[model samples]
Target: MAGLACAGQLAAAGHRPLVLDKGRGIGGRMATRRVEIAGQACGFDHGAQYFTIRDPEFRMALSPLADAIAPWDDGGSEPRFVGRPGMSSLPKAMAEGIDLRQGVEVLALRRDGSAWLLETKGGLVMARHLVMTMPAPQAARLLGRDHPLVPRLDCVRMAPCLTLMAAFPGAAPRPFLHHSSGTDPLAWIAQDSSKPGRHAGLTCWVAQADPDWSAGHLEEAPDSLVRLMLPLLAKTIGAEPEMALHASAHRWRYARVTTPLGTPCLADEDGTLWLGGDWCLGARVEAAWQSGTALAKALTRHLHAG
Candidate 1:
């Protein structure tokens, strides 16, 4: 979503931009998957549950996709929105006219004269300015040697989260329940199929483990971790899930931002390189969008000054 927004603003200002992601598809964390059982398909948004818009600029920027995305439980009051069909649709909508390259991981970034060179698995590309929207640790790894933003990067911290999705053969014991632990491995648990989708008879559950738990078991086997988490989910939901059609574990090494920078954005020494992500502001979709917009404005100013 950040890449798409950045590319959109840059293109609107008459600058061509290329967006690349290491994942198989766009929408870094706003991910969705199709779980098939008995020749029936069910959509599940296993990543982010919902996104909230706190800033006016972000709300205005998202207004175009507002119809495609609707506010969740309008009477609640907090401005939370979900994709009309699913969360992934929001990012797909934003990437409408941009040149996007998926499944391309960036290997390294180096400065050459007045231009920035990005080395990816595919090849190398040169850009007058470089905008990085990855997590602090990942971004630091990409920019090997010391740079202006390296010092500040040390202050950034990320939390890990593990989401477990299970499909049952029959109806769930309970309709829906959101569970959280005060200080346990379990953080949040939700029924996936319960949230605006088909496959009602087949129960789907998502369990997000706390940061400490995820960090400790990051290297453990996927099956082992799932076994440890299944009981907690079963107890919370009041029944044991039967016939696990699909049980998968996702380790989000950079799931949440613990300490965010005070500023909404940051620029490199040469003004040609800028950094932005959820960590710059807060850990939410809105923060990501705001960071991208701020970087775009800063880049526009830098380009005009040149």
Candidate 2:
């Protein structure tokens, strides 16, 4: 989202930018999955469950998505907007007509003459300017082990998340649409089938382990993790584990920002190399978008001045 938002603003200003993602598709945390079970099309929004828009600019930016973005009445402090069909739909919408490369991971970054050379498994990519929107830790890795930026990024901390996606045949007990229990092994649980535009057949559920639990089982095997979580989910939601048609687990090493940068972006002395993301502001889609948009505007101003 941060990359897409930054690129979108730059493109709107007549500066075309290319986006590269290591994932199979867009929407890093805003992810979704579809599986076939018992001749049913089951879906799970395994990452971000929902997003709220407070910034007017974000609302304006999202207005074009129309029905793809809908108000989810989850009884929050304010209106909660979620991407229809699946959470990934939001990033897919933002990336419309933009130059995007999926399944390509940038292995390293180096300074080459007046441009930044990005080394990937496929080949090398060169750019006059660079904006890295990955997590602070990831950005640090690209900058090398002992770069000056590493010390500055020490304050930024992120937590991991272990997610379980399960599908149950027939009407599984849905005590609530969404529930968060910081004390329980399953810290957050959401009935994915209740979300708007999701495929309705089996009762789909997404459960997330709290940061502590996720960290403990960070390296656990997916099948083993799923085995450990499914029974807890069944006990919580009153579903039979044996009736689960599909069950899987995913681990997010940098799931949420525990400590933020408290700024929109960090840039080199020349303002050509920059870093920004949700961690720059807060842990929300709105924050990521704002950081990206703000960084683009800042880069535009700096370039014009140069």
Candidate 3:
């Protein structure tokens, strides 16, 4: 969300900003996983379940892509919104005119005279200005501890998340749209199928473990995590584990920002390198958009001044 937001705004300002990601597709945490069960294709929003639009600019930014957005009546009062069909839809739409190169991993970062050189697996790519929109720890590691920007990231802390996606027959019990528990190992469980624009053929459920539980089993294998979380979800939803048509687990190392940097973004003395993400503010999607947008505006001013 942060990377795409920054890139989108920069592009709108008539600047060509290049976005490189190691993942094969767009939308880092706002992801959707597709699976075939009983020959029916189903999607699970295993990453970010839903997002709320409190910022006016965010609402305006999404107005142009209304077709890809939907209201998720999670019984919440604040009016939550989700990407239609899948959570990845919004990010994919936001990436429409941006120059994004996926599957390009940056191994190292170095200053080459007036520009920044990124040593990616594909080779070196140079940029007069560089923005690191990844998680704080990842950006810190890439910049090394000695880098000035790294110190600012030390105050930011993120928590991991272990999510389980399971699909069962359509007759499974629909207890609630979403359930959250602080003490339960499975902290959050939502009926992914109940959301707008989702396939109704199968009953899909997305379960996320609490931070403590997730951190404890962070190193476990995917299959092991699935085995551990499947029964818990089945019990909560009043379904049998054997009745599941498809089941999988995903681990997000830095899923939620527990302690944010309390700022919009960070930049070096030269204003050539920058760091920003959801960790800059709260964990909401709006925070990422705000951080990225703020960073882009600052960068625009700097470029114009030069």
Best by lDDT: 3
lDDT of 2 at 171: 61
Instruction: By lDDT, rank the candidates, best first.
Output: 3, 2, 1
Residue 14 lDDT (model 2) = 87
Alpha-carbon lDDT of model 1? 0.78
Which parts of model 1 have CA positions greater than 4 angstroms off?
74-77, 170-177, 197-201
lDDT of 3 by residue, 1-306 (tens): 999999999999999999999987689999999888899999999999999998889999999999989999867789998899999999999999899999999999999999999999899999999999999999999999899878889999999999999998974554546456567799899999988999998999999999999999999999999999999998988888999999999999999999999999999999999889999998988899999999999999999999
| Per-residue accuracy of model 2 over 87-145 as CA lDDT, tens digit each | 88889998998999999899999998899999999999999999999889999888987
Better of 2 and 3 by lDDT: 3
Ranking by TM-score: 3, 2, 1
How many clashes in each structure? 0, 0, 0
Q: Which stretches of candidate 3 lie over 4 Å from their true place?
A: 171-173
Candidate 2 segments whose C-alpha is farther than 4 A from its true place: 178-182
TM-score of 3: 0.98
Model 3 RMSD in Å is 1.1
Which residue pairs collide, candidate 2? none
